[model samples]
Target: MTPGTPGNHGPGPGDSSTMTTVESPRARVLPWLSTLARLVLGGVWIAAGVAKITDLDASVRAVRAYALLPEAVVQIVGPGLPPAEILLGALLVLGVGVRVGAVISTVLMAAFVVGIASAWIRGLSIDCGCFGSGGALAPGAEPTYGRELARDGGLLVLALFLVRWPAGRWALDAVLTRKDPT
Candidate 1:
């Protein structure tokens, strides 16, 4: 077929515009949904970190319950994670330094997966302690490290996506970087 001519099979280049039709309503809505997800998840991480900072002792206890860390390590990691999380979350939410933040978040999620897996292997029931306090493992319940891994893995993927595709619609990054004809 000619360049502008309609193909007998696939879409022709001339007929194809930059904006192609999505097959599903969901496919069309996914971008907006992704933006919202980033915002919400980022906010949640920030809030959880702040809350844990306000109550380090509780956070430490929650971390210890995972039975994955040495007590000495817990003393350091438990206290440090909140501040790190706060920084990462803020960067992600603001769309500033998002690549770095996503990397950090991915690391944290990986750590969480390790902790959960170790606890499960050792037959220890414990909370993942993902979102600050109030999370606890129920007795006789096998640890769901696999689930936590999947959940956080998905979140990490989302973070990476957000880093690549910024929340440009309504974000501080866009505001600060707006081009002005000077």
Candidate 2:
């Protein structure tokens, strides 16, 4: 209450005592977040691909149940996609060609979101093929499209962040940078 003294604008709950209000450029946080996001999303994709690869038929059926694709397209896309997911996930997590992988992930997730929403809107009971056969129970039953949409929406946000910032920190790109003797 002392007019001569500075106001007490102390840290709030969940804040550490050591935390200081330092001004940082927006440019700095984005790449770090992008790297973290890439790894996190990549892990999910890896798990999904691995699970599906274990049960190809189940995955194929799940994709088919979506009723979003032609049978011929499903036959071709279903089997091959799992491996591609695995590869992309691995590349992303490993920080190899991470920007490219993030771009691919963003595109794929966007496509899935569209497909799942279309099925749900049309009142088709189908599997989302999200986490392979573990996405939703009962093939002929209407899956929890809202939940799946939310999850994919979250992932899409991360993907967009990656697309903007890229996995630049602690990555091969950083390692390859020329040393600057400032």
Q: Which model scores highest in lDDT?
A: 2
- Candidate 1 yields a Cα-based lDDT of 0.63
* 1-182: candidate 2 lDDT, tens digit per residue: 21112332332222211243553544345445766897888888898899888777777787787777899988877788889889988887766666677788899999989988998899876668777773346745657889989999998888787776663444554433324464
How much lDDT does candidate 2 score? Answer: 0.71
Q: Runs in model 2 with CA error above 4 Å?
A: 1-25, 134-142, 176-182
Per-model CA lDDT versus the true structure: 0.63, 0.71
Residue 164 accuracy (lDDT) in model 2: 63
* Residue-wise C-alpha lDDT for candidate 1, range 3-103, written one tens digit per residue: 22222223222221123353455434543554575676678688879888888887888888876679999889888888988877777766565455666
- Structural similarity to truth (TM-score) of each candidate: 0.65, 0.77
Q: Provide C-alpha RMSD values for all models, in order.
A: 9.6, 10.5
